[model samples]
Target: MTSHHNAPAEGGTEELSRSLTNRHIQLIAIGGAIGTGLFMGSGKTISVAGPSVILVYMIIGFMLYFVMRAMGELLLSRSGYRNFADFAGDILGPWAAFFTGWTYWFCWIVTGVADVIVIASVYIKFWLPTIPLWIPALVVIALLIVLNLPSVKGFGETEFWFAMIKIVAIVALIVIGLILIFTGFTHNYANGTATASFMNLFTTGGGFFGGEFMGFVMGFQIAVFAFVGIELVGTAAAETKNPEHNLPKAVNAIPIRILLFYVGSLVILMSVVPWQNFSKDESPFVMLFSLAGLGAAAHIVNLVVLTSALSSANSGIYSTSRMVYALATDGDAPRPFAKLTGRKVPRNALFLSGVFLLSSIVLMVFGLDKSTGFSIVTTISSLCFMFVWTIILISYLVYRKRRPMDHETSKFKMPGGLFMPYLVMAFFAFLLWAFTRDPDTLAGLIATPIWFALVGIGYLVLRRNPAHQAARAAHLAKVADEQANARAWQDQQLNASR
Candidate 1:
């Protein structure tokens, strides 16, 4: 394959087809933002934060929008900002790139593992309800890897449908929820005031701040999950037909999606059934569907959850490969990952990433009995994604400072840039605190450093390799020599003119 680095000015990707359309982009945003997290765990979020989860969703949605806006501005400001890892390195530094790139790659690989576990555990019921979880987990890992190898658009198309399945399910659920909410169709056995009304959002979530400030703070847990892939739209910046136009359109659509899907759905759920009673044993969507007495509703919602996990893993792989591709191009990762197929897909990097994704299965094999291990992996994925998110915000800070003129002209400038960045930073730090406080999420926080330690060790080992060391030295020396020559040429030209 010809080097994308030197390819004609038009298209840059080699392995991926430009088969994605506006509908695809819209659904990608829709599919990504709403996932298993919202359908399955949102009930838990509402239970914890009460109706204030609405505010939680709103607040997190608002802040994450800035992150996307920052990503959009940086990408549009320069063609070089193809992916987040590349943008981090260009604006922040090589270390920033190395950290962001590898960490993000690890983020998905870890997340894919979690998805595998969920699939094997939940979907096994369809065929052999008695089968051990590990058996199905292995099958899923192999199946996903095979599917991913077909090429990016194939992956995109599959994900499009996977996402479509999820989107359709949620949209249907929302419609049904709205109907029950208006018609008082839900059983009101205990709660006398379960009739059609709007105050249910406030009343059902265990009366606002269920406990106190702590209860409100706990809401972030569920809020964070709902917003997990909120930045997913930005990951497709380079591949989209017209990024600047589509990216902002994608970003701006978040509010409506959050409103109808998250805020709207939650309103109906809590309104019908008090949020306090929901749990992992029961999903609010499933509960509502069953309440409607819909035939095979549990099975239907299970399929939705299954689709959600698969979509999450699918997005994870795409993002992981891109991170590897970006790092390879920048010389942070091995050059082979930089290889792209004629269709503009990073096949080599993708293949290499597939190899790493097996860690999830391996994790499932040994950790099946240990819920602790599962929790740790979950937290680590969250922490790693959080780290990646923070770097994006920081990269924007550096980008704006480094190029005020370019930013001024940027069509997608981040609003309230300086102040908002600080506020978001503080909010993130508070999230870190929340992680420490929550048992379910704490394992992940503890697990992340150990994961990073291995990455750091790998980086050091790679940096020490003789061939790579020489390449680094040569690249640095070439850059220095070029700078020196430019300085000398400037002086000579000035003297000659004088």
Candidate 2:
């Protein structure tokens, strides 16, 4: 571990504090599962896929559940592993770790940038139409960094309340929507009309799969962005209290959360407002409230969404900084990022990520429309996130191949064994093809490789550095020794039991 000299009175440790409790972990997981994408992007998805976007969310959630399970099993398999990147480096190679860590870091940074843009342009302007976009954007960035700078527990708590607001808003929407449906409400639009009832889900416009084949496919382009941070629990493993207990609890409940939060919310929203009535540029939740003549409540929903975007940006800052800190520990990033403050927070890494988030302000200055800017960043984010998710599955497959005994002895085995990873990867490949079907998404798809190319070039340069080589070699050797010891211990335990 790297030590900081001239440490402050409260600063000396080079380790992250495991201060996040079960409540924090559970809420963080909930917050991760529900994102700004669900609140803001769902409008676009409904406009595109009609009623079938419900299925799109279910499919994405189902596949990602397996990914979470795979991650949980891998993290618990070895005590030395910090996050997926650590195991990726150990099982795959140093280059895998370098790519996975940096890619995951970039994933959140891009997502954070989008969140910033949304906060500034869409949500903030919903109230203060006259306010400058950059002012609120910078304020949000500073607030998140300051809150996160105190401790891991602070971030967890901030996320907890943020997640709670989202939960309350969605629950309120669902309850209110159900009431509207039961009372037989009717909405008259300039183009057409819709009735608030469950039947609308099927009889809205084109039926359940209303948009036809291509429309259904196009749904994945935006819906995928909603699930980008689902694996956040995996990243916070090191800072979690009693991860073995909390991690599986969080991962295992994902299915129920999806059914309740994503599927349930959408089902009610569509039932209340009808799929065809949703606007691509507006939030369905806000529309639902507006339809009920609850203009104040609609404004409140918009505020909740503003906070939702802030929550996503906050999570991005927290996770990206930790990833940088992890990379630095492995010598994959700048050494300074490895430094921990008195609270064990990665101050330098946090500041760097916050600085990068300012790019969203620049995008605003360039006068890019909110819809265009959001689509570009989110599409790129979804693609990069897919790359990171693929790395996790690939790492899991290699871990199984190399350590069958560990799999046999594991407590939290992935339900599908060896077949699920391949299945999920195939689904992701289908999503990539789906991305290419839309022009906006296709532009993002085409541009995403530039990021990988840059990372690859950086990795090549770092590989030639003698210091990095030695550090990486030492890290790999250490991982090997730890794995060997773990295997021996397992064997001894089995023998003793016999």
The window of 10 residues in a row where model 1 has the poorest summed lDDT is 1-10
Q: On a 0 to 100 scale, what is the lDDT of residue 388 in model 1?
A: 82
Task: For candidate 2, write residues 1-498 as lDDT tens digits.
Answer: 111111221233657889989998898899999988788789989889989999999999999999999999999988767788888887788888889999999999988888888788877887899999999999989998899999998999899999999999988888899889998888788667777888888986889989888888988887988888999999899899999899999999999999999999999998887787788878788788887778696679788988888888889999999889888777778778888898899899999999999988888899874666567777898998899889899999988876877888899999996799999999999998998887788888889999999999999999987757876677567667757876887798789999
Tell me the whole-model lDDT of each prediction, alpha carbons only.
0.72, 0.86
Model 1 residue 321 distance off true place after TM-score fit, in angstroms: 1.6
For model 1, how does the per-residue alpha-carbon lDDT over 117-185 read when each residue is reduced to its tens digit?
A: 778766655657888776777677667667766666676677789878886887888788778777866
Q: What would the TM-scores of all predictions be?
A: 0.87, 0.93
Model 1 lDDT, residue 215, Cα: 68
Candidate 2 whole-model C-alpha lDDT, 0 to 1? 0.86
